[model samples]
Target: MVGLLLVVTLLTYIIPAGQYARDTAGNILTDDQFSYLDEQTPVSILDMLMLLMDGLIS
Candidate 1:
């Protein structure tokens, strides 16, 4: 489990994060509405740890 967390943390740095657009009805937009931004905010190590904990708890 620790190893998987470590791998995911590493991937957070390597991967280009993206966001999906949502419609007024709160549904995720389709491929045509999706856009990859030029800027990617880096996820902190602490945030990653917290996210892992949250995932495990939920």
Candidate 2:
């Protein structure tokens, strides 16, 4: 399981970042406005753990 987590952590660096276009209403627009970001944001193990905890709590 630790190895799997390590692999997933590494894959986050390989994946390109992206975002959905938001309108004036501050809501995500599902139009053809989806685009990849110029920079890559890699996920840290602590962040992954925090997300996991949030999921479990919710």
Candidate 3:
């Protein structure tokens, strides 16, 4: 489990994050508007660790 968590955390840094637009009904529209953000906010290692702990605890 720890190994999997570590892998996922590393992937978060390597993968380019993306976003999708939502319509009035709150449904995600993956049309032309969907795109990979050029500037991705970096997630701190501590934050990722805390998130994993929180998920396990909850």
Task: Report every candidate's CA lDDT.
Answer: 0.77, 0.84, 0.80
Tell me model 1's lDDT, rounded to 2 decimals: 0.77
C-alpha lDDT (0 to 100) for residue 32 of candidate 2 = 73
Best by lDDT: 2
For each candidate, what TM-score against the reference? 0.57, 0.54, 0.63
lDDT string for model 3 (1-58, tens) is 7788777777888898998877878876857677789898767778888987899899
lDDT by residue for model 1 (28-53), tens: 67556766679877677788889878
lDDT of 2 by residue, 1-58 (tens): 7688778988998878898888889876767788998878898988988877898899
**Candidate 3, after superposition: displacement of residue 42 in Å?**
3.3
Error of 1 at 54 (Å): 6.3
Model 2 reaches what TM-score against the true structure?
A: 0.54
How many Å off is the CA of 19 in candidate 3?
1.0
| Per-residue error (Å), model 1, residue 9 | 0.5
List where candidate 3 sits over 4 angstroms from the true fold.
none
Going through the candidates in order, what is the number of backbone clashes in each?
Answer: 0, 0, 0
On TM-score, the leading prediction is: 3
